[model samples]
Target: MTIWEMLAVFAAGIGAGTINTIVGSGTLITFPVLLATGLPPVTATVSNALGLIPGSVSGAIGYRAELAGQRPRVLRLAVAAAIGGLCGAVLLTVLPPTAFETIVPVLVALALVLVVLQPRITRAVQRRRDRDGRTATPGDRGGPLLFAGLLLASVYGGYFTAAQGIVYLSLMGILLDDTLQRLNAAKNVLAAVVNSVAALFFVFAAHFDWTAVALIAVGSTIGGQLGARIGRRLPPQVLRVLIVVIGSAAILQLLTR
Candidate 1:
């Protein structure tokens, strides 16, 4: 790639990483930019997956505080996620891409709806928690349901990972505690394992656009740092609004692309 093109791609990577760290739609940005640059769809998909792997790692690392008491839980769930991710990656290699393509519109629509309603839903849940007059226990997280949901989410991630964070959040609510921030932390680590294991598969078995991956990696790693800083400083309301707006835009762009 020429220097200018490299700059553009790397900039997109930074944007993608920031978005991924904030809302989990980084793939929507990076994939289209790569496809527009003339990379084949599958190649872009694979390379973008590889590129985002580091961002996921950094995001998880950035959530170390929330993860302090959840090591055993995270490890147990990680086993399920690793196996599911491997299965999903194998399916990605075998299934007709069209089968999964048909779900993109529906997935995008759901993600948009989630973005719109999550705040209201969270508020209602918070009210319920307050009324119950009990301190929220993080241990109440539903491990089995979470494991199952991770399997389903991984299938989608393996096929086409765009706005997957919403899916994880959606599922987290079902089986986890009432705290949004804690759920968000779990979402990050789970996503990291999913992307990393699948990227490992593509690295060993598939052709990758290393130039694009490298550019995205460098930019996204920097973006991840900024995102973590912002996450530390921002209010929950500000974060919610930003996540919804960007997530909505990302899903819309993915459908059109």
Candidate 2:
């Protein structure tokens, strides 16, 4: 890569890491940047997945305080995410590049819709909880329904992980009966597992650009820390709007290309 390209990819990584830590659609930032740098679509996706792993880990660790007492919840959800992620990685390796290119725009659009509707969904959940006379408590452990929902989400995460945190947050908010903060902490860990597991598969079986990986890894690590500090401070409506704008841009980029 040229120096300019390297700088661009690194910058994209920082943005991705920050967004991923704050919300969960960092791939939308990095994947397009990698493509703009002249990598093939499949190669860019694989490299992006591998490159973002460190940032995911960093984001998860940044939420360690919120993760407290959620070991059983995380572990249970992790198994489903791992299996789904492995399947997704295998599919990515075997599928034609045209398949990914054709489908990704649709996926990004769907993710955008989810991000836009998150607040409405949260309110609906709150109403249901009120009607049911239930309150979020530390003792809540999500059951089979949540596991199934997470498995589906993880499969998508493995396949194409833009705005995946939105999906997780929505599901957790509706099903798990917890604060958004705690659910977000769980989302980070599950997202990390999905990405890390898929990255492992891609490293062994797929094509990737190592220079891109290195730049993204370093930049994303820094972004993750910053996101942990700054993302929490942003108002929910503002963050939702940001996610919509970014996701919409990703869709436009994909469709135009």
* Shift of residue 199 alpha carbon in model 2, Å: 1.0
As for candidate 1, its clashing pairs are 142-175
Per residue, candidate 2 scores C-alpha lDDT tens digits across 207-243 of 9999999999998988888787776677666766766
List the pairs of residues colliding in candidate 2: 25-163
How far out, in Å, is residue 251 in model 2? 4.1
Model 1 per-residue lDDT tens digits across residues 1-257? 77887888899888877777766778877887888788887788888888888887787777677676777667777776777777777777777756777776577567556655766765676688799985556776565767887777777876677777777776665556545566667777877888888889988877789999999988888877666666656665676677667666865675665
- What CA root-mean-square deviation does each model show from the true structure? 2.7, 2.5
| Distance from true location, Cα of 25 in model 2, Å | 1.5
CA deviation > 4 Å runs, candidate 2: 98-136, 250-254
- Given candidate 1, what's the lDDT at residue 107? 71
Largest lDDT belongs to which candidate? 2
Clashes of each: 1, 1
